[model samples]
Every structure is written in structure tokens, then in C-alpha cells.
Target: MRIKTVQAWWVQIPIEESRQHVSDFGRLRTFDAAILRIETEDGVVGWGEGKNAAGSAGQYAALVHLLNHEFGPRLIGRDASQITAIWEDLYNGSRASAAAARGHALPELARRGLTVAAISAIDIALWDIRGKALDQPVWALLGGRSAPRLPAYASGGWADSAGIGAQLQSYVEAGGFRAVKMRVGSMDDRPQVSAQRVRAARKALGPDVELMVDAHGTYTVAEAKRFAALVEDCDLAWFEEPVTADDHRGLAEFRAATMIPIATGESECSRFDFASLISHRAADILQPDPAFCGGITEAMRIAALASSFNLRLAPHLWAGAPCFFAGLHVLAAAPSGYIVEFSLGANPMIHSLSRVPVTVQDGMIAVPDAPGLGLDMDTDVIARYARQ
Candidate 1:
């Protein structure tokens, strides 16, 4: 069947004040998600999430436009199973402009985020089509060598002292999540204060639970070191984004100073960006967002790079709809074992947008057994929440 139409949706998932608290960088706030849907001639459809963040609605809308007006037109009628060829066309085609723009260069982030998200949706759609064509699950088509069930981690977003205890305990009780991540670095001035928060969180989770800290790239090299050393005995799994993502030299220095392993690259959009971190030995683990990068194809390449250096590939996921599935496929396919960040604060829109809500059981997610990307988009929910 020929490809017919590609649609992209950008939605706002409302987070109430009770949900927001000081964490990692600033006060926890409502997050907006950029989601996509691709439809083909014979009624096959696939969905994806873009790398949209707290206040990036406009950028996500622009991405929807790019996919519909520019990118979508080119892919129509092309074999949906030709995922690799389609990916190369989009990535290589953007070479000149990608080189011209750099990291978080507002213009660059927009260009890269939109372009990457669109390509990702297409890649995911292609995988879905491939599964349907082969009458097998996407995981099988992706090469199923590992066990079907995937491990997950309880990723905390709330920051206040009053809120942290209940949220941490609930995940342990219900999710059976052995590893958990918490936010730190709410105040930039008091490095010691940050350390105290880390220590407190560690104590609350207990020594048996594997704890991880996310600074959200808010600390300076010196502050990161001071904070890490204070809780060096806390047994943190890793310190994530303590310094800004772009500062490779600073990251290398921080890695040298602290015994804690450094984890980052959630903001990164390509493998080339990861090259710097790997080359500098700046981080012990790499957290790539498939929605932010070029998609499953590029994520595989990034995972391979991380594997070469013997680093862990724990994806940074805190968005809506398609983000989890896209990350799931890559993590499942990755040679090195991986764990995904599961939010205690579940997005309400998740069930509405997905054909199947993820099969999360006791903190472990089971891979989808259906063909294509294994999940379908419930467009009815999309129509209900469509931004007016």
C-alpha cells in the first residue's frame, strides 16, 4: 500500500500546582508534549513524540508544520519498510544546516528538534509498517535476542521535603523499582544545601535502593564537585547533568573530581554531540532521547558509540505519548542493557493518545508483541485534546 498522509499533534498536558515543586533546576512546572501521527493508504498508522519541553509549544507546532508541509510530501508512496534509506535521506539532507547551527542555539534547537522529531516519527512509522508486512512484532524485526520484559526506574520530579517521602515510598511499594532518581540543585547559591538534599533523599530511599541525582545542568564545575563529594558515601548510581550539557571540558573536570559517575546528553540531538562527551571521558553514562535525536536509527548508532566506551544507556524520558515507545524500541534493541525513567507523575494524556497504554507491571515494562511499532494511536483521543 502507498503512504497517504502524515499528521503531527502538539498538546499541552496540564500539571496542577500540587504537582509542581522545586527540583533539580527550578520549580517543577507543567510540561508540554509534542506528539506525531503518520497514516498510510491502507489505514496503517504510527505515532511518535518530539523533544518538546516546558515552554516549547511554538517550536513543536513548527515541527508539525515541517512534517506536514516539507517532510511528509517527500515520503508519500515510498516503501514504508525502507526505514534505513528514509532515515539517511533526512539526516544527510540536513548536513549543511545542521553544521551551521549549534547546541541550544534557540534557532538550532528548534531546527534540530523539529527536523529530528519528524524523521523519528517517519522511522517509527516505517518500523510499524515493516512489522505489519512481516506479520511479526517490531522487536522481532529489530532483532529479538534479549528477554521480552524490560526493567524500569522510578524517576521523581517533585522537590519539596514534604512531598518527597510519600512519592519515594509509593514507587517502592507499588512499582518494585529497585533504582530511583530524584531531583537536586534547586538553589544555586548553597552548594552545601544541595548536598543536604541529596543526603536526605539517599537516607529516605535507604541504602538498598539504588539512588540517582539529576542536577538538570544547573551547577558549576566547582559546585558539582562540592555537592558530589559531600554525598560520595551515599552510593548514588550516577550524577546527571550537574553542569550544563554543552560544557564538555567542565564535564571532564567534574568527572575527574568526583567518584560519582557522570550521566548526561538528554538535551543532545545527535551522535556527533555525543562524540565530544565520549572522547573527553566526561560522562560514565549517556542518556539520549530518541525523540530529540534522529529516532531509532540514530539512537542505535548512539547506543553503539556508548557501548564502545563501555558506558550505560539509560534514556532520559519525561514527556508524553510517543516518547516512551520510541525510547522503548531502541532500549530493547540496544546491545548493552538499559533502564528507562518512569515518572510517578503519569501523564493523563498517555492512554488517550496511545492505542495501548504501556504494559507496566511491578516496575518492569513488557515489550509489545504486535506488528509495526507494536502500538497504535487512538486518534479519537487526539481529536478530543486537539489544540484549538
Candidate 2:
């Protein structure tokens, strides 16, 4: 079936409790999601979400513009079944060569973060359509079930800015979570202060719970090493993006210096970037966000590449329901030792968009078996939060 129409929506949902949730990046205020919907000629519609890398106003606008003006027009009237060809065409045609041929003054689109985000949304929507047309779950189409329920970790504990440890305590006491990820590097140039926060979180979490720290690429190589040394006794599950994701050599050096496994790639957009990450031995765990890393197709490729390098897959999910469900399918079909990152924050998009809420029971997320992404979208909620 040919793609009949493509539409994108920019939704900005205000955070209910606008407390200062400080990460290394800064305070997060709202959830901005660029939602894409693709319809085939016969009236099958599929949903997808684009990555809002830093939750900036410009980033959201760019994603919507890329999909609406650049990517959507190219996909209309094309056979939806040719997923591979469509992906390649979008990837190659959006690059510098195509821009030069078309005399477009726009920058090189292949490596552009906004371009990749748009492509990821379209690719995911196409996959959803494929799964619905074939009457199979996306995971089944990928290969088959590798796990009944994917292991999940509650990601929260953003430096208790209110001086009340209620957030972290609540997450730790939350019975279903087996592991929890806390934010570090909120002290900016001081890794020592961030290390102190890690120590406090470790103490509050107690023993037996797997604790992971995310620096959000705020630390330098020396600072990361120093922080690693300070927290060596806490027994961290992994150190996430201690250095900037683009610094492969720095990441490798940080990984070598620390005993904790290094997990990164949430900012990564393509398999080629991941190839560099793996080839350089930059990370022991690769966290590819399907919404950012060219959707399910490229994420699967990243997973395979990580597996070949004896690394593990733990999808980095910080988007809406569509992306979360997509991540579930990836985790369900991925090899063993893979974990799913479950956001433990207040996101109406994740909590209110789906008819059925996703829950982690005993630290395991039950895989949805319905066709496509298996999520029944809540249109009312979408309308309520749609940006005017």
C-alpha cells in the first residue's frame, strides 16, 4: 500500500509539579514531543514520536518542520511495504549530495540531529503499519520473543533540589523496581559535589538495589575519573555519559579508568555513530533510543553491533508512549542482559496517552502482544496537550 498522507503534531505538556529537577543538563520544565502519524492508502494509520534531545523550544520546532516540509513530502505516494528502500532513500536523499543536486541551501541533513529525528519518526510509523498489515507484533516481525518480560530500571533521583528526598525515597520504596538510575553532575564543574550526591543516594537506596548514575555528559575525563574513584565503594551498575557522547576517545579513557560499566548513546542518531562508539570500545553498554537512532530498524542494527562487540543493549527512552512501546519491543526481542529504561518522572504523555498504563511488576515489564506497537492512543489527552 502506498502512503496516502503524513502528519506531525508538536505537543508540549507542562510538568504538573514544576519542582527543580536538576540533572547535569539543567532543570527540566516540560515534556515536548513531536508526534508523527502515517496513513496508508487502505486507511491503516500508525503512530511514532521524534526525539526532543534537550527539550528546547527550537528543537521541537525543527523536528516538526523537518517532518512536515522535508521528510513527509518524500514519503507520500511511495509503497509503504518497501521499508528498507524508504529508509535508504530518506537517509541518502537528505544528505549533502541530494542537497547539492536539488540546489537546496539547507545544511547536510544526514548527520543533522533534527533530520535524523524526523526520519526516526517516519521509520517507526512505517514499521507500525507493516506490523498491522502482517497481523503480527513488531517484536515477532523483528525475530521472535527472546524474553517474556523485559527487565526494567526506574530512572529518577534527579538531585533532590527541594531539599526533600521524597522523590528518591519513593522510587526506592517502589516495590516493582529492581534497579534505579539517579542523576549526577548537577554541580556543574565540580565532580566532587556530584559524587557526594551519589553517595547520599546510595545510602538512601540501601544495598541490593542496582544503582546507576547519569552525568548527562557533564564531566571531563579527569573529573569522571575522580568521581569514579570517589564512588568506587557504592557499587554502581553503570556510569552513563560521564563525558560528552561525541568524545569517543575521552569516553574510552573514562571507561578504562572506572570499574563501573560505561553506558551511553542516548544522543546518538545513527548506526554509523554507534559503529564508532563500539569500534572504539567507548561503552560497555549501548543505550540507543529508537526514536533518536533511526527508529526500530537502526536500533536493531545498533543492538546487533553491540552484541558483536560483547556489549549489552539498554534502550534510552525519554519520549512519549509510542517511543516507550517501541523501546519495549526492542528490549523484548533483544538478547539477554538487556534492560529497559523506565522513566519514573511525571510525564503525562507516557502516563495518560495509552489506554492501558505500562507497569513494571517485580522489575519486569510485560511485553504487549497486540499488533503494531500495541498501544491504544488516547486522542482526548493528545488534544488536551497539543501545542496551539
Candidate 3:
């Protein structure tokens, strides 16, 4: 079972509705979903999706060319199961370029957000290939603790006090959900004002909701602290990305000052990037996105590092067709850290992309027992929605 060919494609599915948060608007997400078709001499082929949500179609396209033209040529006869060596080859050999890109090819830079996204897609595809070769789920291959299911949280994007409140209520009433997170930091930076909104949400959702707030890294240390202190009584699950990703020290300061746990890492790239955050004890929770943080391989490594510090691992997911399953595989194997982020809005790409529509029952996602991430793509849907 050697990798015969690695192919990548750019897919564009029109998001029926614009995804609006505090400071950003996702009207048209142009992402590159890498379909790595690893073929065996015996004629068995497996598919994988490496999708970048930061719109890295172009960068991912470049990576796809490199993989198929350069790396694929070298790996044609090599065992597809050698994922670690291949990942190391891509990492160390690609390090100079990766450093030059400075996550520009990844997602740390605004202009090259798509490039990082592309890397994410390809990386995910590689994992799928590795899993298929071993006849195991990506999580088990990655040495994740086995669990039949994992807890989840409702990630409401850009809902106001009223709109968000209703969304939370619906999730709780539906069962399967133990926690919920709301997007915050849309308005002014007054801590008290944000507190009032949280208070209102709490009143509407009641006390046991395990409320959490995401500032989208739109606040400063002072403002984050202000909001954190006020919401201490709100029974927050965690405070996510209160300050910008650049402000690791600011996050450290904010965490030190607040009683609420500080959660971040979605914006971070590789394990090296997260190592600094862990060493500094900057955040109490880690939210690594498989799409943004390389892929399952890197995410598993990040989760392990977080476990050493007794930190929580909750992946940050927006709405990508393949990313949900990709994320689920990693979370499934993860020990103790099981909650995954979910979108409240209707996303056709996620529902229609899979061979099986991903279902969430009682706020917990069931792990698919099938091979290679347990997902199959609908090419017709891809053809209809594929970016022209």
C-alpha cells in the first residue's frame, strides 16, 4: 500500500447566508478542499479533505501541486502508512519555506490566510490516507483514547442578545448539549455593557447552561479583564480569545487577572507555536482547529501538550463539510478532552458534502466506525458547488 497519487481540488460552495461575527464577515468563503486520492497497486483508493477556512485556496493549490508533482513522485513506492516520516519530511524540509511564510502559507497572516487553510486541507488528506492504510480511525492511529462519543457545544455565530438567546434555548431543549458558547465583543468595549448582554443571555437560558463567551480576540487586556470579572458569576465554561492572537502576553495577563478560564489556540499554527503558549501558562483552555492548526497530526500533538498542563482541548470549528469529521476523529481519540464546537446556522456544505449527513444527537457527536475518517464525498454536490 503505497501512495500512488495525491490530487487536490478547490471547492466553492455558496454559503446560503453570510457568517457574520463581531469584526469579520464571511460572505463568500473561497477554500481549497484537498482530495488526496491515495491509490494502491491493488487498485484501492481512499479520499481525504484538507480544507482551510481562512480562504487559502491559492496556497493550498500551490501545496497540491507540490504534493502531486514533487512529493508524490518521491513517495509513489513508499508505504502510505509512514505518516510520521512523511509529516516530518514535509515539516523539516518545508520548514524554511514555512518560516518564510510565517504562517502566511498557514493562517497567522491576513493575506495568506488561504495558504494556511490549504496546508490544513492537505494535511487532513494525508491523515485519511494513513488511517486507511492501517484500517483504523485517524484518532486511533494518532494514539487517541477510545470513546464512542464526545460532548459538544453550540457555537452561535453573531447572534444578538435575543437571537442568540433563542438559539441557546433550542440547543438545550433538543438534548445532547451540555454547554453553549455565544459570540461576544461585537459592540463597544465597556465591560459592564458586555456583562449586561451576558446577564440577559443567562436569564433567558437559565443558570445551568454552562455559558461561554467568545470575544473573537476583539478586546484588549483591560477590556477582556473587565468583561471577565463581571461574568464570573455567570458560570462561564471558558473565555475564548479575548485578545488578539498576537497578544500572547496580553492573554497571559488577562488570564492571571481573571477568574474565568482563558481559551485560545485556533489562530495558532503548529506545535512549536503552541509550545510557547504552554510554557508561559498563557491560557487555561486550548482550542486548536484541525483546519488552521495543520491537521489531526498537529492537533493531537497540541492536545497532548495541553493534557500535560491539565488544560482543556475544545476544537474551534466554523462550518466546513469535511472539517467536522476531521475534527471529530481527533476529538474522539483525545483523552478526557472531548467537546467540539458546532455552528447554529444551517450549513448545506456540511450536510450535503458527506456520504452520510453528520447527525448530532443530544449535543454529542457519534464517532463513525467506517474507514478513513468515516466520510465519503458527494461529487455531484461538489460539481454543482465547486468554485468556478
Candidate 4:
């Protein structure tokens, strides 16, 4: 089928609880997502979501604009099944624009940051359309089902204004999450303070539960090492983005200093960047978010690269329902070491974006059997949160 129309929405749903979540990026009080809907000539519609540039102002608007004006126009008349060719065209188009501007060459990550997110959403939507046309699940399209249910980890435990420990305890008790990840490195300059927060979360979680910490790339090599040293006693599952993702050498240094497995790559957009991370031995676990890493197509490439290196793939998901489903497919296709990250907090977009909210049962999420991400968007929810 041929592409007919592409639509994008810049949505911001208010967090119901309005809790102050302190992280390396600062406080997060709303769920901002860029949702994309692609329509085929045959009347098939598929949905996708771009990662919300949390702290960057106007990033969401830029994503919507890029999708509507640039990417959408290019995809309008193309064969929907030519996903690989379309992805190359998009990547080359972005690179050509950079080359025409000046002799200055923006790094792959920097160049992709400008348009890859828009490309990601469009690519995912196209895949969804393809799956619907073929009447096959995305996971099956990727490769036959690898597991019955993928293990999920609760992704909350943010340093809430009320109490980090209490927030974690409540999520575990209510969600039945076997594993949890908490925010760390909020006090960038103070490793001791960050370590204290990690200790508190471990204490609340006790010894039976698995605990992980995400620094969100807020620390220097020295700071990450110091914090890791302090929290080593807690037996962390992994240290996520302890230092800036860009600092591969620094990340390697941090990894060498701590026995805790290093996890990075949420900001990475392509397989090339992930290859660099593996070559540099920067991380043991690779967390590529489909919304940020050039959609499901590129995520598969990154997953293959990770598997070759025996590195684990745990998709980084913190967006709306579309992203969550996209991540789920990737996790389902990934090897045994993979796990899904489910947001534990209350975000109206996550709970309401689709007619049937994605849920975790007994700390595991079953793969959706329906075609094309197996989700039906709730237009009412989109109308309620669409930017006016």
C-alpha cells in the first residue's frame, strides 16, 4: 500500500498526582509526548510516538513540525513496504542538509537529535501499517515470539517530594514489580547525597527485590565512581547513564571502577553509535528507546549488535503508549538477558492514550497478539491533551 497522510500531535498530559520528581534533568510534572498517526491509501492507520525532550523547550513542537512538513511530505507517495529504503532516504536527507549548510559536520548523535526522533515515529508508524496489512504481530514480523511474557521492572522510585523510600515501597506493593529503578545523581556535585538516596531506596525495597539506579547522565567520571562506591553495598542491578552518554571513555572508566554493570544508550539514535559504545566497552547493558533510537527498525539493528557482543538489551521506555508498545516488541524479540521497563507513576497519557491501557501482571507483560502494535488509540484522550 502507498502512504496517504501523516499527522502529528504535540501532547502534554498533566500528572494526576503532581508529585515533585527530582532527577538529573530536574523535576518532571507532566507527560509530554509527540504522537504520530500515519494513514495508508487503503485506509490503514498506524500510530507511533516520539520521545519527549523533557527539559528542552520547543523540542516537542519541533518534532511535530518536522513530521508534518519534512518527513511526512517525503513519505506521502512512497511504498509503505519499503521501510529500509525509506529509512536510508531519511537519514541521507538529514545528512545532506548538514553538508549543504557548511563544512561543519555534526556528530551522528547531534545530527540525529535534530531529526531522528521525527524519523523514529514515522518509521514506527510505517511498521505498524505494514504489520496491520500483513495481519501479523510486530514481534512476529521481527522474529517469532522469543518468550511468553517478558519480565518488567518498575521505573518509578523518583526522588519524590513526599519521600523516595515511600514512593518505591508503594509502587512495589501495588504494582507487584519484582524489579525497580530509582533516580540518582540529582545532587550532581554531591556524590554523598546521591549515594544516600540510593541507600534509602535499597533499604525500603529490602534484599529480595532488585534495585537499579539511573543517573540520567548527570555525573562526571569521578562523581559516578564515588556514588557507585558508596552504593556498592546495596547490590544494584545496574548503573544507568552514570555519566554523559557522549563520554564513552568516561563511561568506560566508570564501568571499570565499579562491579555494577553499566547501562547507557537511551540517547543514542543509531546502530553506529551503539557499536561505538560496545567497542569502547562503555556499558554492559544497552538501553535503546525505540522513540529516540530511530524507531523499531534501528532498534533491531542495535539489538543484533548487542547480542553479538553478549551485551544485554533493556529498552528504555518513558513516553506514551505507542513508545511503550514499541519497546515491548523489541524486548520480546531480544535475547534472554532483556527486560522491559514499565513506568510506575501516574501519567494520564500512558493510562489513557489507548482504549486498553498496557498493564503489567505479576511483574511481567504479555506480548500483544493483535497486528500493528495491537493498540487502538483513544482520540478523546488525544483531543483532551493536544496542545492548543
Candidate 5:
């Protein structure tokens, strides 16, 4: 099962005006991603995705170029089944042989960021190829699924305090979602204002439904603490990325100050960074994005950390088809896995880029039993949106 070809694309799909919502990211005009497609010599094809930014709104041309021009060539004749070895080789760069022999990473200076993202894409595609080769689902290859289906929390809220409640309630009604999350921090100008919005949402949705707030890592330690105090009675399921990813100590500080669960990891890339968070006791919930955090391989490693530390796993699934599917399989296999994050906003990459629909029933998402990532790309959509 040798890899014959590897290709990547920067697919940019514009969000139709009617469905657009503006927030901290400022008018997300287009949804973008670095998508990878790999084919084996025997005609087995696999797909993957890489993320460079949070919220699926960042540039991906460079990421796509890295996969196509640099990482893609190295896999031309390699065995598709040696996924871990290939990941180590890509991660350690020219020191692949020495690093492999050393029993630990001796990575290049460019170990993180786009380099890891490129590796993430390759690793995901390799897993897809392996699953197809064995005629098993990716989760099955990960040692069988934890359950048949998992619950999902609606992940979008951008309206004002008065409108926010209705907005989140609509998300609940749309798919019978029992939990919903909304944006907090800088956009509202003050922590107090963001808290007011949360209160209004709580009043509208009532207590039975769970509520969550994400600052997009846009708040200071003090500001986050204040927000937590203001909404201490509101019963937030978790407070996500209260401080920047660069400040694990501050996040740990925030976590110490509040009873609310702290979930962070979308902006992070690799198991080493997650180990640092675990060391700091910074989070109660781990939120690794399969695309950003070295794909399914490293996500499982992070999940192991979560399970080891008595934390919960909730992958950030706000990107394209491959990334989302990768998260599903990982969550299905993760011992600490919790609910899925279903994007409530209009995402063409999730809806238009894949032939199969990502449906939610009774507020839950079923883990796909189909071979590979259980997705078929809509090539027509790719052709129209691909930039490279």
C-alpha cells in the first residue's frame, strides 16, 4: 500500500450574506481551510485537513503550499500503513533517522505552526488510507468506539444580550440541542457587558439547557475572573480560552479562581503543548482541534493525558469535513470524551464541501461506522473554491 500521489488545496468558500454573523473575528466573509487529498498506488484515496487559525477564517495558502511542495513529496513511495513512523519523520525533519533511533523527539526549530499543521494533514490522510485498506472505520482502528452516538452542543451565538437568548434558543430548537455556547470578552467592550448577555441567554433558555462562553482567548486574567464572578450563578458548563494560549499560568490562575470548567487548545498544536497545560493544571476540559493539533494521532495522545488526569475531551470541530470527521473518530475512541461541538453557523465547508450531510438528531451525533473518515468530498465544490 504505497502512496502514489499527495495533493493539497486552499479551498475558500464564501459565506452567503444572509447567513453571515460578525463577532471578534470581524465579519467572517469566507470560510477557508488547507485540504489534503492522497491516493495510494492501488487506487485507494484518502482525505485530510489542516487548520492554521481558530474559527476556520484564516489564510491557508501557505499551509496548502507546505503540504504540496514540501511534505507531500516525501510520501511518494512510502508505506501508507506506517502512519506513526511517517508522522515522526515529518515532525523531526532531516533528523528522522536519528530521532527515530533516539526514542524521543529531536525536532527542528519549525516543529510547530504550519509544519505541524502539514504533518497533521498527512497523518490524517494516512489514517484514512489505513482504514480503507482494512475496510474498517477509523474509530474501529482506534480500538472500537466508546458508544454508538455522542451528544453535541450547538456552537454559535453572536447576537446582543436581548437577541442572544433567542439566537441560542433557535440553535436548541434547530437540532434539539441541550447545550449552547456563545462568544464573550473584548467584543462586548467589558466583562460586565458579556455577563449581561449570558444572563439574558440563561433567562431565555431556562436552567435545563446548559450554557457555555468562549472569549476566543481575548481576555486578561482579571477580566476573565470578573466575568466568572458575574455569572457565577448562571451555571456555565465551561469557560473556554479565557486567556491567550500563550499564558498557561494565567489560565491556571483563572481556573483556580472559578468553579467553571476551563477548556482550551484550538490555538495550540501538538501533544507537548498539551502536556504543559496538564502540568500547570490549567484546564478541566481539553479542547484539541484534530486539524490543528497534529491530527487524530496526537489528539489521541492528548486524550490519553485527559483520561490520565481525570479531565474531559471535547474536540474543536468548527472546520472542514476531514477535520470534523477526524474529531468524531477520536471522540468515539477517547475514554474522557464528552459531547461534540456542532457549528450552528452556516459553514459551506461542512455542508457544501461534503456529499454526506452532518446531521444531528435528538441533540446527538452518531459516530460513522463507514470505512475511512466516512466522507466523500464534493469535487464540484472543491473545483469552484480551490485557490491552489
Candidate 6:
């Protein structure tokens, strides 16, 4: 189907103070995303999302502007089904033709960051359109789902040493979650304090519940090592984003020193960045965010790397509906896929944004079989919270 219209909105849903959790991203007052809509000439519409910052705390006006003023215009009258070609076209810019002919990327200088995030939104929308046009789910189009339901881990814990345990337990009791994650690193002032919080959570959840700690890429290599050493007996499921994505060498070093599986990449963009992680032997798990890592196409490419490299795939899903659904589809189809990250924080992007709210039943979420993303967008939510 030919693309007819491309539009985006900066949906900024305010998080109530009581429900909000503070992290390295600061107070996280608002949940932000570039929510994209792509409609075909035949009236088929698809949804997408893009992120430029961590934990739903970035300014999406720039991302929305790019979609409306720049990327959106490029999609006009183009074939919505040729996803890969479109991705390459947007990524390579003027050199797309040459890049295609040469069988590798000769990308634009602005190939990463906001540029890729913009492309991510478009690619996700195209996939949604492709699935709907074919009258199949996105997972089915990719290949087929690995299982009917996948395990989900609660992905929010910002409470301090005393309160963190109760907070995580509340998530476990609320969703029947067997696994949970908590924040560590910079927010706690020191590695030792962060370690104490993790230990306290471990004691509360007991040995049966799976525990994970995320630094949100806010730690130095030395600090991550210290945190890992302190919690060595806690038996962590994984250590997520212990160090910044910029320090692959440091990540690899910490990953080597610790027995915990190193999960990072939500801050990263595209398959090339993932390839570097693999090449450096940095991570045992790859955490691609469908919104930021070049959408479903590039995310699947990263999944391929995970499968090939014998790494685990647990996509970062603390994002909007399109991105969240895209990750579910990827996890369903990808062989390397493991657990899903279900946000425990107050996120309108997932539950409030959809008519049929996605729920995790007994620590697992069912893979959707409906055409495109099964969860229908709540137009009212879009209209109400949309930042002009």
C-alpha cells in the first residue's frame, strides 16, 4: 500500500507524584514519546513510537518535529510494505542507492541518535501497516511466535534500602511476577548504598524470586564491579546497563569480573552498535529498545546477533504502545528471545494508551494473534495528553 499520510504527536502524560519513582533520569515528571501514525492511500493505518532518552523522560518535540517536517514527507507516496528498503533509505540518506549497490551501509553523518530514532518510528509504523495489510500479526509476518506466552519481569524499583523490598514485593503480589528489577548506581550516591538496597530486596523477595538491578548506564566500571561483588551471593538474574553504552571496554571488563549476566543496549541505536558489543564480548544479554534501536527491523537484526552469539534477548519495553508491542512481536518470533520487561511504574504509554490494556497473567503475557498490534490505540488518550 502506498503511504498517504505521516503524522506524529509528542504525547506527554504527566505522572502523579505518588506514583512516580525517581531515577538517574531525575524526577521523571512526564512520560514522553514521539507517537507516529502512518496511513496508506487505501486507508490502512499503522502506529509507531520513538525514544531519544531513558525511562520515558526525554523531550519528544524534536522527535515529533522530525517526523512531521522531515521524515514524514519522505514517506509520502512510498510503498509502505518495503520496510528494509525504507529503513536503508532513511538511514543512508543521499547515499542510499550507493549503499544498496555496495551491499553495506554508507550512512549519513547523522546516522545515530535522533536521526535513527526518527527512522525507528517510521520503520515500526511500516511493519504495523505491513501486518494489517496482510491480515496477520507482526510476529506471524516475522516468522512465527516461539511460544504462546512469554515470562514477564516487573521493571521498576526506585525505593531506598528500607522501602525497596516492600516496593518490589508489591509489584510481585500485584502481577504474580516471579522476577523483578530495581535501580542502583548514581541515584543511591555510592555503590555500597545501592548494594544494600539490592540485598534488602533480595531478603524481601527471598531466594525464589528472580532479582535484577539496573544502573541505567549511570555507573563507572569500578563502581559496577563493587556493586556486583557485594551482591554476588544474591544470585541476580542479570545486571542491566551497569555502565554507559559509550564504554564497551568498561562493560566488557565488568561483565568478565562478575558472574551476573550483563544486559545493556536500551541506550544504543541500530545493529552496528550491537555488533560492537558482541565483538567486544561485552554482554551476555542484548537489551534492544524497539523504539530507539531502529525499530522492529533493526531490532530483529540485533536479535539475530543475539541468537548467533549465544546471547539472551530481553527487549527494553518501558516505552509507548507501538514500541512495546513491537518488542513483544520480536520476542515472540526471535529464537534468542527470553523474558519481557513489563513496567511497574505509572506508564500511560502501555496500559492507558491502549483500549485493550496489555496484562501479564501469572508472570507471563500472551502473544497477540490479532492483525498488526492487537492492542488498539486509545484515541482519547492521544488527544488528551498530546503536547502541541
- The CA lDDT at 80 in model 3 is 64
Off by over 4 Å in 6: none
lDDT agreement with native, every candidate:
0.72, 0.81, 0.68, 0.81, 0.91, 0.91
Lowest summed lDDT window (length 10), candidate 6: 53-62
Estimate the TM-score for candidate 1: 0.89
Worst ten-residue run, lDDT, model 2? Answer: 103-112
What's the lDDT of the predicted structure labeled candidate 2? 0.81
Q: What stretches of model 4 exceed 4 Å from their correct place?
A: 55-58, 94-110, 160-162
Clashing residue pairs found in predicted model 1: 128-372, 128-373
RMSD in Å for model 2: 3.6
Reference-based lDDT, residue 112, model 2: 50
lDDT of 2 at 244: 86
Candidate 5 overall lDDT versus native: 0.91
Error of 6 at 21 (Å): 1.4
Model 5 per-residue lDDT tens digits across residues 125-222 = 88998999999999999988989899999999989998999999999999999999999989899999999999999999999999999999999999
Model 3 lDDT per residue over 86-145, tens place: 555455454535644564323233322344444465567667766766678777766754
TM, every model: 0.89, 0.92, 0.84, 0.92, 0.99, 0.98
Q: Which residue pairs collide in model 4, if any?
A: none
